[model samples]
Target: MPVVFFAEGSAAMGPEARAVVARAAERARAWPGVPVVVRGLAATDGSAGFGRALSEARARNVADALVAAGVSPDRIRVQPRGPVPYEAMQVESRRVEIAIGG
Candidate 1:
């Protein structure tokens, strides 16, 4: 199992999105291939209900894809949202965390 943090490269996420992804990936290294946490970000009106749902769905899709790609369901996690820098993310998307013990 390998942990991979994924985020969209949308312009709305700003230039810092890559940096955020890198930091998340670094954090993920702690568990190697065991516990995987994925985070996705998108730009929307930040007020539409449908948009939020779509974002969450995208995140879940990524996580599920990872599983299909070879990761165990028990070792997969996902977190999705439209986040702001430095502030606590509202989790407008979703969060999934899994750890497969060695």
Candidate 2:
């Protein structure tokens, strides 16, 4: 899985995130027939509704970034897993995971 980390409370992509996306794009280009899944995740700090909305927006932002990185929008799918509290550090939860599959 290629993962992009976001800054605290923001959906803006940083250098690290862009690098991850670039790598994912490269992998997508290498295997053009594969489907890329971009999973957006959010921290569990806020209300459920707020977290869901934020996660969805963050997911879309990641998908947009992937498109900007030259991956066809049609080849990417966005899945927002809202407010998963698995990460001990809240900041670590703010991320988008890109996985290539059939």
Candidate 3:
């Protein structure tokens, strides 16, 4: 899994996130027949609805990046995992995990 962090309350991709997406896209392109799962996650902040929407947006952003990088859209699945556990750390909690073989 290749992980990329997001801002606390935003889905905008920064340079680091874009780099991660590029790496993941490369892996997906390597194994063209494999499925790519983009799991979007949020920190334990704000309301549940807020987290859900944020995660969804983040997942879509990553998925869009993958397709732009030449990964097939059909091979990508966006899984909005919503909020992380309340005890999860800030840096690690707000992220999306790109799983190339699930």
Candidate 4:
């Protein structure tokens, strides 16, 4: 699983995150028939509804990037795991993890 982090309150991915997604897309291309699971996560913000929406947006954005990178949309699954209970010190929970395997 490769994690791509995003700034708090935003669903956008930076260049480095996009690179990770690109690599994941390549791996998905290499192994046909395997499913790609993209889990979107968010920090413990004040509002649960906002957090859920943000996380979902993050997942869809990453999924779109994967498709743009040539991965088939049929093999991709987006799961938004709402905000975490707590944020780790300097680490925020705003991220989407790309999990690809058999």
Model 1 misplaced stretches (Cα beyond 4 Å): 1-33, 46-48, 83-102
Residue-by-residue lDDT tens digits, candidate 3, 1-102: 899899888899999999999998998999999999999988766788888888889999999999999999999999999876646767777889999998
Worst 10-residue lDDT window, candidate 3: 84-93
Sort the predicted structures by TM-score, highest score first. 3, 4, 2, 1
lDDT of 4 by residue, 1-102 (tens): 888998878898899999999898989999988999999988764788887888899999999999999888999999999877655522547788899972
Candidate 2 vs candidate 3, TM-score winner: 3
Which parts of model 4 have CA positions greater than 4 angstroms off?
87-92
| lDDT of candidate 1 over 23-72, digit per residue (tens) | 44444445456576555554444554544554566556655555554455
lDDT of 2 by residue, 1-102 (tens): 888888766778888888888888888888888898988888866687776777778889888987887888999898988776635658767888888883
Strongest candidate by TM-score: 3
Q: Count steric clashes of candidate 1.
A: 4
- Backbone clash pairs for candidate 4 read none
Candidate 3 clashes: the total is: 0
All models, RMSD in angstroms: 7.6, 1.8, 1.2, 1.7
